[model samples]
Target: MSDSLLQLSAIDIATGSNPLYTVLWMHGLGADGNDFVPVVQTLDLPATPIRFLFPHAPLQPVTINGGHTMRAWYDIQHTDFIKQEDKAGLYRSQRAIVALIEHENQRGIPSSHIILAGFSQGAAMALHVGLRHPDKLAGIMVLSGYLPLVHEIRQEAHVANQLTPIFMAHGSYDPVVPVKLARSSLQLLRDYHYSVDWHEYPMAHAVCDQELIDISRWLKNILKEALISDHQNR
Candidate 1:
């Protein structure tokens, strides 16, 4: 699957005539890319031109959900996410996401000017793929999700994103992905010395108004820094 081209469908949003920065945002399990479209409109972003890509995950059977087919990045074999790992599905989706990043590169946006982000299962993908991506990225943003395939990350993580900033937020009352799991992931990243900015909301399994504000601020800051770095390198 890694060698094959991915034909995943997506919705594109360009904030200006020519976008200088790109964000690849993935949706949660069972949901399409359109899940987070409305949230983008609520963010108070900077004046910098940006392009946002929301890609739909491929349809697959989820074992934990009674083998029901849905749009999931990987299959969940059990409620204990760490127990039964889906290596094949995770790596396949990682390659598909890498294809999207490469697509952005072909369209004139460098990896340094791109941000990979997601929510829930999508968030897990963002952490999994961004860490292993061979090129430097602007940043990674994760919301209401835990890290998957944690055991393999240390060996497989690329050096390009070793210092990339990470923004993680979670709902305090999230039942789907317990806040404890999110905290453990944060701790793991920190233990590995990754730069992580963490936040907790008073909601459950979803984003809130304050979380959107924080996301906007983080995005603007990273983009601003990326623009500066790009100019300096040129």
Candidate 2:
């Protein structure tokens, strides 16, 4: 499918008047944008105004789930996720997400003022796309997900976001994506010299209160730096 045809429906939340930053957060398999909406209110963000876009993944038949139709960024062929990859689905979703970032730029938010984030399958997409994005982004936050299409990342990643700050958190007891897989992904990024801030929570394949607090603090720092940098550039 064409990128235009894959246009996603999203939930938009603005934190204050004249928002200066934008956050595009994606949800995991079988979930919609509304999945993370409640977490927004809990984040202890800075006083700066911010806008959040929670986009619903396209509906597709997931193979691992007995070909059941559900909202997924891409298909999961097997439990051994690294072996069988979904290149086409990933590329399609990447284009759709890039379109969302461009939409924010069109609305007056620079790419540098945007942060890409996700959980589970959504977190995989954040890592896949954010690294390849041609423009510099404020940062990327990934929770409970592993890097997909690993072979292509080294060749496809863009220099613009090479040094972009990355916040990665994984649950130690994540049965779905496995803590080991997440750690391997982290090692790959680190081997490539990516600046990553890592955290681990003693939970499952889900977000927790402490994770929310850490995310809030990380976002606060990132946006604060962005604001300062933007002011200096003026």
TM-score, each model? 0.97, 0.98
Candidate 1 lDDT over 53-135, as tens digits, reads 99999988899999999999998898888888898999999888998999999999989999999999999999999999999
On residues 81-175, what C-alpha lDDT tens digit does candidate 2 reach at each position? 88788889999999999999999999999999999999999999999999999999999999999899888989999999998999999999999
C-alpha lDDT values of all predictions: 0.92, 0.94
TM-score of 2: 0.98
Q: Name the Cα RMSD for model 2.
A: 0.9
Best by lDDT: 2
